[model samples]
Target chain A: MMVSQRPSEVSTSAHERVYRTLRSRIMYGEIAPGQALTLRGIGREFEVSMTPARESVRRLVAEGALFLSSSGRVSTPELSNERIEELAALRALIEVELASRALPRAHMALIDRLQGINMTVAEMISKRDAVGYIRANLEFHRALYLRAQAPAMLAMAETVWLQMGPTMRALYGRLRRTEPPRNHKLIIAALKAGDEPGLRLAVRSDVTQGLRMLAG
Target chain B: MMVSQRPSEVSTSAHERVYRTLRSRIMYGEIAPGQALTLRGIGREFEVSMTPARESVRRLVAEGALFLSSSGRVSTPELSNERIEELAALRALIEVELASRALPRAHMALIDRLQGINMTVAEMISKRDAVGYIRANLEFHRALYLRAQAPAMLAMAETVWLQMGPTMRALYGRLRRTEPPRNHKLIIAALKAGDEPGLRLAVRSDVTQGLRMLAG
Candidate 1:
């Protein structure tokens, strides 16, 4: 999720800094699932004490972005198939509402911006840059949801994205697609036409189509 | 807001136990908004050390159920009107989908159980017991959403509840009503008729109406 702050290595508290850095990496699918992590390793990598590393790990665990064992071992989550399906359904239900809400506010400038982002997504696909593709795809949706003028709803939707991150990386890695995101085109067209229902359908279709590949 | 576990007073680690208890109380609206909390006070209340108390507070803060000031003081959240509206919209979006998914699985016995819970909600309202009413009303929603077999969706809906708990307590306390939950009856009727659209509308109305009272 956005977590409301950029990671500043300069002045924030150690744990807060670690929390933001780890949160962003997880939300953007930089981490792989089931990868074991230790407080010592995190402390070493971030050049912080173990206390802050442990606290940051605890914070991420609270956000459902990471898993912690009873013995205090921590790892990126390996979501079950059932959990994956539910998150996909949630994305469909919420993003459709967000896109519909944004429809009245979407102007040509916004549409042009989305098209630019879509091009970056296409570039990522061609370059086989998984993280870049994930970042650009989220940027496209974030740009849309921002117009909804609903921060709470946007934050919740982004949390679902955070939870889906590692698994999405796996899903995308397994299914290589040559085509650009056709559903994004539909989203842009619906916006241009100010079609609320069409926008909802396009958003839902885009979310579900990508997810169904994992399910199948 | 169930957090899928009961608050255990024994055997578990002190922090885990404290987290579960505080989570349940906050989720159930047992705490009031703007209620200032200190780590020292929590340690005393739960008869635990400051370490566990601090850890639990950190977890709740991470979950958005509690707010922490820059000075590190903690308090139950007092939501703004706009935030409340967004959460209500979220509820309508997610719960309607959950109810629709549950419809085919909602047997007569399930419907009967909901009727029983609704009766308890009515009783609590009549008794002018705000917390009891909130708990029963949530139980009513929970019992129905449980049948959806969508754990992740249910968990998301419950987090909205957790975030709203204090505000909901404050809202219901101000608006005393003589009638039972009328929209709930419509929900039951729609469920019985197997009308998906009716069910969605009923659920949406039920979710929106209670929240609108606070909005007004």
Candidate 2:
């Protein structure tokens, strides 16, 4: 007998399945910066043909989540300090606006949801799981931003996040922090208080602070 | 004997050539919003096989320059009013920052080049050439932003431009202006006076003023 599958899983196309899974892995810092990927290897790993594999890579490359070299090699980007700073600034610009838009709509349930995600972020930190930490942290921010009803802005912010993922992994190794980011608490408090400027500042600081150290 | 070709043209891959040409067409509003494109049609037009055409389409879709429906139709996006506003806000945020960053680096030569581009923009507007006007307008903004030395930020800004391309064509038709945007002159004045805040305001106004009306 066939095993039951989730409705979403059942509806996903093979190429889309491969694309979503690979995109998450890269975006969560499961892949290291400058790591190379081969179409043959990806096809074998995902149990798909080269066409789907190539399409996924092309999509990721277009999103700036992957880099394609002149020699026809595909790899995660190894961003320079300047590039890192620019991406971080973009995150600050976009995410701060997202947070500000989300402020008036930030109900008790959303704040609670953010708090719950923050706990997961702390748990990942304590467990020393860098990828999990990054994923949870993003979830926390995304949960807040979702209330903004600004899909285009959120997408832009996520693209910046995807571009920074590998570098964030590298930074996680260098950081070795025992606590979660303090800015998350500030963000939550600002949201609860309905403080737009505070929320914007907190969001900007939360997004840019860590990356600034790396850029420096 | 084979006709002479440009070195850049000779070096471009089949897919890259197709991708670049198609990207420009879409970005310049040569295509209407909600216009459908078939792979077979694209392949015939470009004299290429299905693979390169598919690749180019996939890349554009990922960049938000095109949309892919669940039924497997590919078309230029017909953006909603809300989406248009969000994208305009994004342009204001990023382009203003880019202009501010580029200010100190804007030499007299660059200002002259910008004026020359503004002339072309006016010429296109007077001729009622929507595509040419869009292309020249982008060139003027891009020439200024290139001095920012922030590729990642610029790429994000360009993606927003790509998404707005078709909508911009519609706006151009509605506008039917006899004069260029007044904000362009303000931008030039601010740059000449080395006024940072003035430069930011001008850039933000220039990018968002036209689109705000469409969204409204």
Candidate 3:
């Protein structure tokens, strides 16, 4: 890869590159809460300068994906029990609407894609791969939301996911359910039947079920 | 004021000062959509260096409070019609939950405070003060969400407000409605009567009404 060729292939600014990488990691439960990070560390890992690293960190902090302590240490957020419950409620609220909006636009092809992702999710669960399971689970939701044509709403929902990443890893690790996601099937069925109320309920149930154990 | 004395009272980092000032302006509808800003201009206005201004602008851009063009110009976002509809759906979904959560904790004092804010909203409408009306309307919602004890969810709701600030001004300016926010009155009544379902409906209606007008 020549240096000139590399620049054209990757035109994004350094900080944006860093931000996207970190965002995905946090969104998919790859990072644990209280995991401290530093600009120098990130710069080294990503082969970028300290300035870009700091900018990326600042963006993440603003989005609640990362937390900054009084002493200025950066880490993934360890949400309080109340905060977790609140985020869960938000997921239920926002994602259900997203599903409903997508319902009208949802086609057989979209449903097929979601069903395929559900299968991947089931495989991840069987393997006890927490991160893979979380990734696939969100993919299912994201695929549905992409059809909703509501970027602003979808962005807000993704922020909730980013904030919940660390906590979700912990939750999924502790839950011993052998069954794959029950409500996902309901969600798919509701979508197929054009059942709006049923779709909303399925989404609400799926969104809340993962966090309910932590609340208990 | 002596330069030395000035730097101490405003001891916040330059970027933070810039971020907070711009955040309030955007959140309160002081800035309109498509209002272009430059890093140099922001630094000059705030009496800071370009670095801080750039940092602040980056944070805002990440939060969807501002937009960044391919040419690197910054401006308040002018949301698309589809985006506005999505945001409206988001508000209805999240706010209904917030109102429901707050219902258990919403006592007489909170209800009284909300009523007071409602009065201000009415006065603003009569005066045709678009900014004042928006501020008071948000205050009413914020007061209720505060009681919900769900900071994370409330924060997400407020972000939606911040993003909608400019459009809200446009929406209010176009509508010649002299009637006080009807749904707000219902919200107050729902709170007074301790009707959970009624509270949810009222809040949903109030959140979605203005956006629906534009969406139509």
lDDT for residue A208 in candidate 3, whole number 0-100: 94
Give candidate 3's error at residue A59 in angstroms.
Answer: 1.0
* Strongest candidate by lDDT: 2
Q: Candidate 2 has which clashing residue pairs, if any?
A: none
Rank the candidate models, highest TM-score first.
Answer: 2, 3, 1
| Candidate 2, A1-216: lDDT as tens digits | 433433456677777988999899999999999999999999999877788899999999999999999988999999988898898889999999999999999999998898999999999889988899999999998999999999999999999999999989989877755877799999999988898888888998998888766745
lDDT of 1: 0.88
> Model 1 off-target regions past 4 Å?
A1-10, B1-10
What TM-scores do the predictions have? 0.92, 0.95, 0.93
Among all windows of 10 consecutive residues in model 2 chain B, the one with the lowest summed lDDT is B1-10
Itemize residue pairs with steric clashes in candidate 1: none
DockQ of all predictions against the true structure, Cα-based: 0.70, 0.88, 0.78
lDDT of 2 by residue, B69-143 (tens): 998899999999899999999999999999999999999999999999999999988998888999999999999
For model 2, state the Cα shift of residue B143 in Å: 0.4
Model 2: how far residue A31 lies from native, Å: 0.6
DockQ of candidate 3 relative to the true structure: 0.78
Per-residue lDDT tens digits of candidate 3, residues A1-216? 433334653677778889999999998889988899999999999887788899999999999999998777999998888788888888887888889989999999999999999999999999999999999999999999999888888888898999999889988988788798899999999999999999999999999997778756
